[model samples]
Target: MRRLIIFALFALASIMAPIANAQWQEAYNNSGAFNGFHFTDSLNGWFSHIGSQKIIHTSDGGNTFDVQLNVALPFNMYDVYMEDNLNGWACGTNTGSGPGYIYRTTNGGADWIQQTHPASQSHWIQIEQVGSSIWFIGSQSVTPNNLLIMKTSDNGSTWDLTSYSQFDASWLFIFDSLNFIVYADEGLLALTTDGGNSWISTTLPSDYQVQRVSFKDNNLGYALVANIWSN
Candidate 1:
């Protein structure tokens, strides 16, 4: 009986080892103070690092990263969205003002142009794309008090704002051309099945300022939060 139990325990341990390894293998850790991240394929992905003042591009499935470009200002890139390698957008704060700025690149970050400056900007929290439609959401300021979302179909040329006053948070997320989700800290989490024309908000548990969210596919995703305490 003792030998049988030992054999059963060994078999269980062998089965559990691979499950633990698979979970770790699926996760990717950003090296620096990361504000935004995106993965186009299993092999190609990008992450924005504030401490490094550059974006890290990984073509070998997040195994290794190559520093792509270092911006003149080491501002925090709060959100990143790319339709493909050649066309992408990075949204974040500028030297001054709370309004976030949008930076566009056509040649895969070799050259970037300031596409839009927020005359009435906020802290951009998230960026996402569905087909040719792109969406961005943020607070009226960095306080995460007033949540707002902007939708554009013709790239970033024009935008339509949808306001949410009840929620004290905002975030941008897209799973595919058919599914997009947004969560505001003010107890609002929404989903859009038909691109960005319309949205549906559902109940959520907490609004404690979720910082980062990642998705491997439409079914699997995770949200990361940091704990803060005041003395």
Candidate 2:
């Protein structure tokens, strides 16, 4: 009984021991809302702020945020992609008719160059990288035919218009590097098997607006929905 009691006490102490915690410091604080955060690990990450016309980057986690660039485009960055501690990309939408922009950084967030996109500057809503390339989707209701899909192989140097769909502000995710799936407004869904070259739209009878979507792999996915109808 005494031996069992001592063992129990040792187990309890081990369970109650404090874990080694790493401290997170406020790396940067701009005068706007930070829309998205992407980090591969605690040492490297990127944050986008829309109202401030800036993207904050940290090579050593959130301990420091340096303004990589000041494009100050008319859009608010909603999402960011960091391929490594150095390579990163950002995509967001503009407020007015100004088209959105996709910016890339190669020198560890020291500077960013905007990709010369064919469509209007205010179109891209969300952007992410799937392997060595980056993909984005843009919407234009007035143009009716301006719903565009773009891909960049050389980081953000240039973009190729790959597909067109009448979807607005769609959320895109890539699985297995080239396979992708997008869920747009009005229950419109799309799947891409060859990078972003072609897409097939699927029907989803959902009354809620899907704000974000993530996939653990090709088989399992989780989506966060807002503006849902309870009735």
In order of appearance, the predictions have TM-scores of 0.65, 0.71
Name the lDDT of candidate 1: 0.65
Instruction: State the weakest 10-residue window (summed lDDT) of model 2.
Output: 1-10
Flag regions of model 2 displaced more than 4 Å.
1-31, 156-158, 176-178, 190-206, 227-231
Clashing pairs in 2: 43-61, 75-94, 98-122, 99-121, 99-122, 100-121, 100-122, 100-123
lDDT of 2 at 213: 65
Task: Give the number of colliding residue pairs in candidate 1.
Answer: 5
Poorest stretch of ten by lDDT in candidate 1 = 1-10
Query: Scored by CA lDDT, what does every candidate get?
Result: 0.65, 0.65
Best by TM-score: 2
